[model samples]
Target: MAVTIFLLIVAAGAILFIYQTFLRDKWIRQKPFPAQHEAILSCNLPIYPALGEDQQHRLKQLILLFLTRKQFYGCAGLEITDEIRITIAGQACLLLLNKGWQTYPKLLSVLVYPSAFRAERDQMQDNGTVAIARHDLLGESWSNGKVILSWDDVEKGVSDFGDGHNVVLHEFAHQLDGLSGSTNGAPPLRSNSYQSWARVFTENFEDLRHRSQRGLATVMDQYGTTNPAEFFAVATEAFFEQPWQLQKARPELFAELQAYYRLDPREWQRSTEND
Candidate 1:
């Protein structure tokens, strides 16, 4: 009886694995998002046209998977619409392209406000005093499987894809960062690349901090100096939006990002120009 029970358990496990590996993928593919392609084209995501045909199709699949799996909620009296959903999802999924197709497995929901929202937090002072502070925020990513954004900023980010200030990208990068069990600058990287990623990020982060302190002009945003995590998120923004400028100003950092993301936006820009 014990052996028979064990064999039954094994058979059930194999059946479950087969269902997950085959049936789940078929179901996801058949799930319809009729406006997916049109949404991608109309969203004004400059990187969309830069991708090859296969990559573009994969991106659409990722976006559809994102829409299927995650929930979007409107906040602060904002009304959620397909355009808003597609716009935000498209930009967020851009980061997943050429990487694994997991559409932020840990992310479950997105909350969007009509504009910048006020958030209050307890601030720890250098003097060891805690004080309540309120600040306006455009976007935020929480480790609790939630992402919040300002619809206004989302639209702005899409409108000016070359500006290197995408709120969606920035916040989503934070989500990716948090996947490593902590919100530190480091995300899960291959064993071989971790050392190189650390070295390059540390050097560039220090340089940006020093430049900010001296009031020197820098291609990266001053907000990056806030912390290592912010530095990674901000760098991700620049890497995608201002690829040419980032490549010119900080080639090593750009190279590191290229290796990590497995694509080169500079090459995309070149292709765009040539065409």
Candidate 2:
């Protein structure tokens, strides 16, 4: 009897774990999103107001699941609050909307600092030796299930929602880029998309790099010239924040992103502008 009971308990535990792992996300989506959270998004997340009702519904579900799953911590004596969590998650969820992928499946945590923070970097020296240096940063994404951000920068990114330079979007783009392994400007793609994505991104990256070297102005950030990975992230920043400009300036690049993201930011912007 004792052995039978023990076996039963283990089986029950296993079943519970399986349910939580598989069924919980669908369960979360079936529920209504909180109104208070919507208020927070409206006030703190500027992009939320621009999203269409259906997109907003999809994003709200993503945000709710994200808040429940990912942990958030405060650094530099900062305090973590629901408002901060909601705002940050809302911004990050913009990338996940209209996709069936689990909410940042690889991400386990978010770390927020009160302001710009310094981190160490390793640089290759002339003789191939490594030199360590420290640099101040507003945001960073780790392939190991972590993202770090400055609260000040987060606030700035949302406040100027039209600037096409959002740190949250930028770093989260890295998170998505790293999903397929090394973030070499290519994330996992649907069938037959790799060729086009690679071609368009390569041309745009090279164009941006040349223009940046010549100190010419462009719709996409000059910082995108840093590398293929940086180009993808910075271009993602522009993709959502200034879609109209990007669509006008680089229609092919915009189309690739529109297809990948499965949503049109131009429509959102147009709706907002018409209002």
lDDT of 1 by residue, 85-160 (tens): 8888888988888887678878999999999999999999999999999999999999999999999999899888
**Candidate 2 C-alpha error for residue 153, in Å:** 0.2
lDDT of 2: 0.90
Write one digit per residue (lDDT tens) for candidate 2, span 1-275: 99999999999999999888778778888788778888999998776777778788888888889988999999999999988898899999999898774787789999999999999999999999999989999999998999999999999998899899889999999998998888889998997999999999999999998888898889998989889999999999999999999999899999999999888888888878888
**Candidate number with greatest TM-score:** 2
TM-score of each: 0.91, 0.91
lDDT of each: 0.88, 0.90
Model 1: how far residue 135 lies from native, Å: 0.8
